[model samples]
Target: MMIKLLAIGKTDSTHLQELISEYEQRLKHYIKFELDIIPDIKNVKNLSEVQQKEKEGEAILKRLQPTDVLVLLDEHGKQHTSIEFSNYLQKKMNAGIKRMVIVIGGPYGFSEEIYQKAQGKLSLSKMTFSHQMVRLFIVEQIYRAFTILKNEPYHHQ
Candidate 1:
């Protein structure tokens, strides 16, 4: 199955971008992965938080295919350990899914519409993280999960 991480805005830090790229490259060896960035909404300062999320949601929804499994990286979602997450991914892969889309919303998070469309939600942590930081974190974890699945030396128990 193809795995796609869809996020809003450009990753501003050069260091973070480099790290994300490293993991992304490693992930390509195991599965089809794509990091799709939806540009930040313009004039967000002029709009309310709800409005901003609404606009961002529109952009996000447009990129999704009906058959794609939408998973939102949400604060209120279930948190899993590295091994558990690996199992979760394996289950999806074994299910014969075409594509799995995981999304990271803008500063305001996702809109009600976006939430309604999501098939599942996952949280990396209980503490808040900058969207830029979260991008690298998720990619690295994805790489780790693949390594664990392959019995590679990249992850430790």
Candidate 2:
């Protein structure tokens, strides 16, 4: 199955961008992976938190296809170990999912409409991280899950 990562804004940190690129390349060896960056909303100083999320949510929803299975990388979502995550990937593949999309929401998080659209939600950690850093974290985890599935030595118990 194809894996798609949709996120708002750009990665400002050069270090994080490089790492994300590395993981993206590694992921290609095992599966089709694409990172689609939705540009940040302009003139955010005037908009309320709810307004911003609504705009962001609209952009996200517009890009989604009817056949895609969306899963949000949310703070309150289900947390899984490396092995379990790998199994989750395998299960999606076994089920013949055409495209698996994982979204990284804005600083204020996703709107109610976005939440309702997702088929599942996953959490990388209980502790908070920057919205920018979460991009790299999810890409790396996707690579790790694939390696674990293939019995590669990338993940350790």
Candidate 3:
């Protein structure tokens, strides 16, 4: 199954982008992985939080395929250990999923429409993180998950 990470805005930190790219490369050895960055909405100063999310949500929806399973990275979502996450992904692969679209929402979070479309939500941590940092964390965890699945010496119990 293909894993697609769709996020809003560009990563301003070159350091973070480099690290995320590293994991993206490593992930290719195990499964198809794509990091698609949606351009940030313009003139956000003029729009309300709801409007911003609606616009971002519209853009996000447009990128998804009819068969794609939508998963949102939400603060209030279910949090799983790295091992548990690997098992979760294993279940999806066994189920013959086509493409899993994981989304990182805008500053104000997702819109009602986006929430309605999502099949599941996952939380990396209870604490908040910058969107850019979250990108790296998710990518690395995915890479680590693959290593764990392969019995590689990357993750420790």
Q: Which predicted model would earn the best lDDT?
A: 3
Q: Could you give candidate 3's per-residue lDDT for residues 1-157 as a string of tens digits?
A: 9999999999999999999999999999999999999999999999999999999999999999999999999999999999999999999999999999999999999999999999999999999999999999999999998998999999998
TM, every model: 0.98, 0.98, 0.99
* Sort by TM-score, top down from the best: 3, 1, 2
Residue ranges of candidate 3 with Cα displaced over 4 Å: none
Candidate 3: residue 88 lDDT (0-100): 94
Give model 1's TM-score versus the native structure.
Answer: 0.98
lDDT of 1 by residue, 39-152 (tens): 989998899999999999999999999999999999999999998999999999999999999999998899999999999999999999999999998999888899989999
Prediction RMSDs, each to the true structure = 0.6, 0.7, 0.5
- Model 1 per-residue lDDT at 139: 91
Put down candidate 2 lDDT per residue, 26-103, tens digits, no spaces. 988999999999999998899999999999999999989999999999989999998899999999999999999999
Reference-based TM-score, model 3: 0.99
Instruction: Please state the error at residue 121 of candidate 3 in Å.
Output: 0.3
Give, for candidate 3, the lowest lDDT window spanning 10 residues.
141-150
